[model samples]
Target chain A: MLKIDNLSVKYQDGNQVLRGLSLSIENGETVGLIGANGAGKSTLLMTLVGILLPLEGTIEIDGLLQDKKNLRELRERIGVVFQNPDDQLFMSSVYDDIAFGLRNYGMSEENIKHKIDYIMKELGVEKLQNMSSHKLSGGEKRIIAIATILVMEPSVIVFDEPSSFLDPKTRRRLIHLLRNVPMTKLIATHDLDMALELCDRVIVLKDGQVYAQGNAKDILTNQKLLEEAGLELPFCLQRIEL
Target chain B: MSEIKKSINRISNLEELTYRDTVIHRLPPVIKLLMTVIFLVTVISFGSEQVSGLFPFLLYPVLLMTVAEIPMRPLLTRLLIALPFTLFAGLSNMFFSKEAAMMLGGIIITKGMLVFVSILIKTILSVMSVLILVSTTSMNDLLYAMLYLHIPTIIVLQIMMTFRYLSVLAGEISVMYHAYILRAPREKGIKLIDMGPFLGQLIIRSFDRADRIYHAMKCRGFEGGVIFSEHKKVRTTHWLGLMIVSVVLLILRFVNLSELIGQLVIG
Candidate 1:
């Protein structure tokens, strides 16, 4: 399980962003992280990745605590896919980017190639292996980004706005892809419909604290709670009500 | 703004050229890097009056361009961009070295003119070899070669990151300039007074982007000073190629092949 206990973070300007936010994700579970513009979703993701060390909180994954000493090992257990695929796909080619983490751990070339080939095949992006990551289309880039993370084989994966730049066809394709992933997933997104389809449970954030948490159906359908959190019901849910 | 866009395209075009597969392109990067260094050092060692000997070195870039399918036009065009500097250095030789060197086809060629020609030849040979190296080798392979040479990994990573994001930086400049123009239509160029804020904004934007990129890299288990490119093993053919090329270049550097060929033709 991935756990964040009473996590609080402050920006350089001294504004508190994530105020005592705590959540836990069980292994093989899909949890939705929904929030308004300044509800600290991005901040929480940054904290999870160890980019911004919390002023006071503890991040635990599996049997390890996130700290200066265990950071490198902890990064292997929890993978983060940032908001921009461009940022994550920094290496020259898709193949290189996918092999980056494994290479960092000093894996042999033969083994790296084996792992990368398998992951690319799994993502159905084998043809894109040699292509420049910068030249890929939005959907293709998104898939490659996912491949980069999945090749690491993390115990838990966190995604920030996975469906943002994709078209409808691509978004549906992504939804399908996310459904097939077996590891624990925390998807922070405003695409409530996708959250409803992919997540078994949902955590709503308001003022950098957990506003509500429960079954996806119960929490997503609770109209008043969503309103207080500065959110609305998924369009699909509204259509069914009509 | 258009210049920045053109620059972005040029960077992409140069990168695209490295994807071509050829025997020269397939050679391990370290051997190629060594051969280039040998070529450059030999070219630089030629004395000012040895213009005739320098003619044989042209064969290297010509053969490379033909075999690798690289166009000469773009390389020469890029050469033109550096012409002013080389041209200045060569022309100054005309003023200092005043001696009658030889007579060519009923005209006297001064030593200064000969020196000028030699300097120009040296510049062309040096620049062409480097450009061909870049056009044929992928950036990652070249960086790996640098690592093989024992360059510090941090420096290599810095170079790789800079080369990778140059176009992105150019794109950012274009967008920011466009937005600035839209906001200040009446101003012609940026006013001196607003320059501080304008440049300050660019710095801030770059910092934010860099911070995000660093975070992304860290998330991928990138500890500082670690290079991910695999070290390619050099094959026998690669070693033989490097040996033969170095010997030929050294021979050309020492022997006046131009004079020997002329003698053979006369006999």
Candidate 2:
């Protein structure tokens, strides 16, 4: 399980971004975090992954307290997929990018290759193993970015806008893939329809606080709660005047 | 301006060429890198008046180009980009050093003219050789070879990150330029008055983007060390290739193969 309790993050100017937010995700659960702009969804995800040092709070990953001593292991266990695949996929080739994290852990090259091949195969991106990351189509790059994280064998996978730039077909494929990934997933996205399809639970953030949380179907379908959180109903849930 | 777009495309093309699988591309980066250094030093060591001596070194770039299958047009295009500086330097020698070295077919061949030709040849060979090395070896392999040879990690990372972000930086500039042009279609490029603010904004934007990239890298366990998971070890064949190339370049530098061949034919 992954846990964040009373987490607070502040910028250098001392403006708090995540305001004492607290949440916990059980093992093998997929949770969708939805919010409008400035709702602190991305900030929360960044803080959870240790990018933003929380001013006050605790983060525990699988019974491991997140301190400077164990931060490396915590990072290895919780993979983050950034909004831009270009930023995360820094290596020259897709294979190298995927192998980067594994190399940091000092895994033998033979084991690294095996693990990468397995992950790419699982993701159905075997052809992309040797291709340059920069050359990939946006959708392909997104999938490969996921592959890079998945190869690390993180216990929990965190995604920030996984389906933002994808076409409808690619979006469907990604949703399908995420649905089958059996691990804890924290996806922060504005794509409510995707959240509805892939998430078991959903949390809505407003003004850097969790305004609503419950079963995915109930919270996403609750029109009043979503409106108060500065979001519209998911496309599938909205009633058309026609 | 289209300058950013052209530059982005050129970088993309050169990087793409590195992905090809060929004999030259398969050569170990360390050996290839060593050969390039030796080739460059040998090419530059030639005295300005020894124009004929530099002629033989042309074989290295020419052979690599042919064997690596790098198209000539782009290669020469990049070569021409470096030509002007050397051209200026060589042109000055034309006026200052005008002692006639020999008579060729009843025409005066001045030492200064020889120096000029020698400088031109040196520029072409050096640029072409470096381009070939970059085109044939992927950036990761080259950087890894540098690390293997104990080049400071800081310098390699600086060079690598600068290269990796060039595309991102170019994309941002292209967007900024597009927005500027849209707002000021009457002007060509940024107005001189606007350049200050324009560049200032770019610097700020670059810092913001750099912060994000650094965060992403750190999240992936970057600890100031380059983690290259994919590397081909330097093997015996690579060592042999290095030795052979070095011997050949050195022999050409001193033995004057042309002179010896001409003597043999005449005798």
Candidate number of the best DockQ: 1
lDDT of 1: 0.87
Candidate 2 lDDT by residue in tens digits, A106-215 = 89999998998888888888998767677789999999888888888899999999998899999999999999888799999999999998999999998888888989
The 0-to-1 C-alpha lDDT of every candidate, in the order given, reads: 0.87, 0.86
Tens digit of per-residue lDDT, candidate 1, span A56-125? 9899999798898888898999899888898888776788888888887778889899999898888888
Model 2, B151-234: lDDT tens per residue?
999999898889888877887788899999999999988899999999898888888778887877777787778766467778
Residue A5 of model 2, lDDT score: 92
lDDT of 1 at A66: 89
User: What lDDT is obtained when candidate 2 is compared to the true structure?
Assistant: 0.86
Clashing pairs in 1: none
Model 2 chain A weakest lDDT span, ten residues long = A127-136
The native-contact fractions of the candidates, in order shown, are 0.67, 0.57
